[model samples]
Target: MNASFSSSSSSKGMMDHGDQPHVLAVDDNLIDRKIVEKLLKNSACKVTTAENGLRALEYLGLGDDQNNTSNVSGLKVNLIITDYCMPGMTGYELLKKIKESSVMKEVPVVIMSSENIPTRINKCLEEGAKMFMLKPIKQSDVKELRCQLMKYGS
Candidate 1:
């Protein structure tokens, strides 16, 4: 795995820089989830996994409400990366749900898909996906995604 693909290291002798962004990686395939988790763990970033969109939503819902206020319950998901195709709830539908929710709407979402059909991509972008990456994932691609997220922080 590329070092750049790793999440920011906690022991790097730097400020906490706020809580390390927790990433939720949703996919039906176990191998796919493992690959993502391994890449994220290398960077020291906190990562959570869900086998489907519904499961992901359960975690997201644990956070505060969409109004941006702490929900008096728990922390919110900092980012979501979901496969575009799934058995129960598609990534598109999950994206829609995230957007509809007040607490989750602001979270950055990236759609990963083997087939980046123009219409699907456009719809996702239209619905508020920050970016999309084609399938057959690579560490370099993950590094680029980290860069994009850093931009938001700045």
Candidate 2:
């Protein structure tokens, strides 16, 4: 193949990959994290999994030494979807932090929980979370995130 042909193909590959939405998923459970990663992948979104809220905060550069963090992998994280009941920090706390962040406040957040508690759902929504979904998330549920992802222009 000629140089031009190879370059064109490479650009095509990048263009397709670059346009996909990048979503950070936080879950304490390994099985749940893997499930979320697979579901998000199937929905055509790039996924990054965090084991707990503190880890997720570190990834977002909101940890103890905020100045030294990577500032979210140098990628435009379009959405954050996290589990509500992680040990170190609950999803509600994470949502509050994100909303408080001047730079990241506008980014949409989705909280997930296995238990469908009304108070928890209401609190997450009132605190600026875009969605509060129950766990064992379906492909269709992940598919629904496309709209939230689209709102961010990812």
User: Highest TM-score, which number?
Assistant: 2
TM-score of each: 0.79, 0.86
- Give the whole-model CA lDDT for all candidates, comma-separated: 0.74, 0.80
lDDT of 1: 0.74
List where candidate 1 sits over 4 angstroms from the true fold.
1-19, 62-73
Which ten contiguous residues of candidate 2 have the minimum total lDDT?
2-11
Off by over 4 Å in 2: 1-17, 68-72
Per-residue lDDT, model 1, residue 21, is 66
Q: Which residue pairs come into collision in candidate 1?
A: 6-43, 7-43, 66-102, 66-103
